[model samples]
Target: MTTEAVLDIAVQALMVAAKLCAPVLVTALVIGLVVSLVQSMTQVQEVTLSFVPKALGAAIALVVTGHWMISTIVTFTTDLYTRMPALVGH
Candidate 1:
């Protein structure tokens, strides 16, 4: 492929990756921030407090978005597989 085509493919792949990870990452970020806030307010320096919420948040996110995540990954994989020959100049 040409340089422009390669870059375009890379960009598209990155965009898809970001989209796939967004829900989980956002959940983790929010949970971490909230837990940090609570810890600060209560002066609780326990490391477990931070970890539990983040883990729970990630689990909840996975449960809720599991289908979407699976579909997104499957679609990406299928698309890539179907285009493999063309990508390889077959």
Candidate 2:
């Protein structure tokens, strides 16, 4: 409706997106760091070692946090949809 309202919604969307993605991203980052450290210590230079663990960590994070992420997104969407008429000044 108003510029402020639009900006507020945009910011909220971004915040929610970041919140939903944080767990997976953080898990992958940590796993990669650990794998790299291990590689450095052991002199094991296999690329797959780092890649596979990070991928699996991200997947497991998704599995564990999937419901909360979906619920947040659904609630946001539903709230937006419910307010559409008012947002349009109808």
Candidate 3:
């Protein structure tokens, strides 16, 4: 493949990876922010308190988006494979 084509593919792969991870990451971010606010308000400051909620939120996000995530990855992989021959000048 040409240099530009290889870079394009790499960028696309990165975008796909970011899209796949966004849900869980956002969930954790929001949960951590809320937990931080609560801890600040109540002065509880328990590290585990922040961790548990974030973990649960991430787990929930993964569960909810699991099917979509799998389908997206599968589609990306299938498309990549289908385009390989052309990319390889076959």
Best by TM-score: 3
- Give the Å shift of residue 83 in candidate 3: 0.5
Off by over 4 Å in 3: none
- Worst 10-residue lDDT window for candidate 3 reads 1-10
RMSD of each: 1.5, 0.8, 0.6
Supply the TM-score for candidate 1: 0.86
Tens-place lDDT per residue, model 3, 19-43, is 9999999999999998999999999
lDDT of 1 by residue, 1-90 (tens): 567767877887898899988998999999899889999999999999999889999999999999998898889879878877877787
lDDT of 2 by residue, 39-81 (tens): 9999999999999999999999999999999999999999889
What residue pairs are clashing in model 2?
A: none
* Model 1 lDDT, residue 54, Cα: 90
Model 3 steric clash pairs:
none
Q: What is the lDDT of residue 78 in candidate 3?
A: 98
Task: Give the clashing residue pairs of candidate 1, or none.
Answer: none
Candidate 2 runs further than 4 Å off: none
Q: Which of 1 and 2 is ahead in lDDT? A: 2
Error of 1 at 18 (Å): 0.8
Candidate 3 lDDT (Cα, whole model)? 0.94
Clashes (candidate 2): 0
Candidate 2 TM-score to native: 0.95
- In angstroms, the error of model 2 at 37 is 0.7
